[model samples]
Target: MTPGGRASTAAPAEATATTITFFGGKGGVGKTTMAAASAIGLADAGWRTLVVSTDPAHSLGDAFGTELTDRPRELSENLWAAEPDAEAAVRRRVAQVTEDARSTLPREVMPAVQRHLAHAAATPGMAESALADLLMDAMERVPGEWDLLVVDSAPTGHLLRLINLPELLGPWVEGLVRQRERVASADSLVAGMVGSQERDSADDDPLLARLRERRGKLERAAERLRAEACVRLVLLPRRMVLAETERAADQLSEAGFRLGPVVLNQIPERPDPRVVEAVWRRFEPQGVLELPLAAEEPVGIERLRPLAR
Candidate 1:
């Protein structure tokens, strides 16, 4: 879809069904620009749209030539923008989990639990989970505050994992909750034998409750993506980008997300037919869309007009 408010020469019919669009590919493929431009186009079409950046190194503001924050800021009529703070999101999630655990675990052991949680929050997957949370939040607000939502995703790996999280983490979370329940049962048995006061029952375990809550959120997010969202892989004509896009497509297919179309951004004036053919043969996307190389850098909304259509 053209990001700029103009009709795309590629696909017109498909645009009507897409309310949430994810622009993702290898880094430097101009996915952020395309996402921002698409949001502009959607808004210009009279659809209230919010374009959000899940990339930790956000460039949506750079594309629009404006500063942005974690909160949604109005860019123009019917268009808004946001960049969720990944680090802060991670910290907040960890804090919630820790607080819930503190209600169950002994006070003396809470300090060590906090330390372990801090380390766990530093892992790579945590950032992706935080971004997933932001994406889910945006999707849940659809048709309420905005008619359309556009996501400028992180580089290929993170984006793929973020989309695949619910499937991968569902069982793992269930297993953790089960193990915690077993431990709680054993602790209760020991307290009874020792005539010590039993702290609480597993029925009221806060950590287990939190785990179930998180799992439920992820399940709903996965359902929203599968049922409502369309994923578009953006790429340049370079060999590396083509190969990466192919891999991304395969992963998306495996994860059960419907692939929308392949967007070829920044096409040169003298395009290579060979490069185009190679992508068509190997990428095999449902549809293909192209954006011409701009005469100058596409910075502001005016410069992005040609692409929007």
Candidate 2:
């Protein structure tokens, strides 16, 4: 424990290879505060850290006492921050996919394709999928630029769904690709038997290639999320919060995600050690961290540095 409250040791020097950390929990559990503080901590310790918020109702900027755009902006010497506009990203994806279809598919097939894209934009998991796409893209663009990535995710349910996206959508996209392949093969066979016009090159089949590409992206995202990231749950020291953490832990474990340390945030000045221990034991995290409730709201680098420690 440090001066203000319990603290974790600085991340080992060897752990500086573009790691991703996710901080998530129920709403109002100080998720943004803990994530921002942790990012600042990592940055202060000499890592190039980029912290981004995936929550639609963004508050990361408020936590930092600064406005953030979709592009990351410097928050300090080593820390940068951004709040991705998920809806905007989804809209862009929809337009891009539709445009690709329009350019490649037959004219008569475009109206139906447009309708399908419209429907997909409203699909249950589309937003989460789009968010995941943004995350993966960020990772790809950060090879030598960033050493640490931290995400202050949406509330537990939504964030978990985002993490599970590849598992949920990968097979669906694969099925679509498989079905398209079967249709294309049958069409070729028919054209051959009837001695019709020669079929175009396989590389010219845009829809099939697009489907395969989507599947590949989803699979890669899912594998990276499971294999290369650390997930931490932030919570208050309330029974309801404890119960929620247990449920979230089970869900994450079942989805093949390993839970890292749990941050017990906003502890009272004279917090009861027994109560904290009891609640922490329920989650059985690798470690438990305690953060004192701030006398004033934590905003800006100065106020946040101590909490980060």
Candidate 3:
């Protein structure tokens, strides 16, 4: 890889196994299409690829033209795809948090909180949090199942907010947990010194327990995302998307991630002089502009192959 587009003598392979997270500034930016094709390309190139859509819209199935359940289904030998059931996902997250909270909260409090969580879980962070949990679960559950995990992400702000969860909430969680732990320890020490015979342990510290659990989960998630090439931008070769992509690139770089590459999902095959191309496009013909206009779905992997690479 060289700035001059000339392959260096010491350059590595043309393609490396990298985690590609697809994001768009807007909904109709073809994030799903680029993600699907990228996954197919990676798989076909002899890399283990898992494509998971965090978008509630769940267009990964439509892109593949196959029945995709909430669980990961084998789209090919090396490729797997999944669209999480957001309802179930929210429930699962809320349940996990509630269960941990129940250890400390009054029994009646959980039921009330659980009812409220149903609607609150429908909010922006809720879905992303659930998806984050699913992502953490995947990394833990199947360590080596995928060499590359391609995340088909939601729209710009939401996706950025989602990925920025750990950094945004980390200090707050740490502070709250630390404060709770200190309070609990002090209360216990005071009780212990005052001759109260309550044998409360760390297990009994619900706030500390929840804090630790949540901290661990978020930390692990952040680690996984920050550890690997977490996100890959899939853009339209249009002006707005390119600007958004640049901003996203800056933010992602700031957030401490190894960005794989920037991919323009769909573009005019012809190099229209009026159209501004990405800096990387050095007078080369771009991808199809009317690609999405085609009625046919996917045209199978063979046809989509051109766009994938």
Per-residue CA lDDT of candidate 1, range 1-309, in tens?
344444657646555567788888888888888998888888887778999998888889999999999899998988999988889999999988788877878899888998999888999877777777877888888756787899896565665665677779978998998998888889889999999988575667888877888888888877777767778899888777788888888888777777887888888987777888888886564888877777788998887756888
Models 1 onward score TM values of 0.85, 0.85, 0.78
Q: Provide the clash count, candidate 2.
A: 0
TM-score winner between 2 and 3, please give it. 2
- Which 10-residue window of candidate 3 scores lowest in summed lDDT? 282-291
Best by lDDT: 1
**Which consecutive 10 residues in model 2 have the weakest lDDT in total?**
1-10
Quantify all predictions' global Cα lDDT against the true fold: 0.81, 0.78, 0.66
Off by over 4 Å in 2: 1-18, 186-202, 270-274, 283-285
Q: Clashes in model 2: which pairs?
A: none
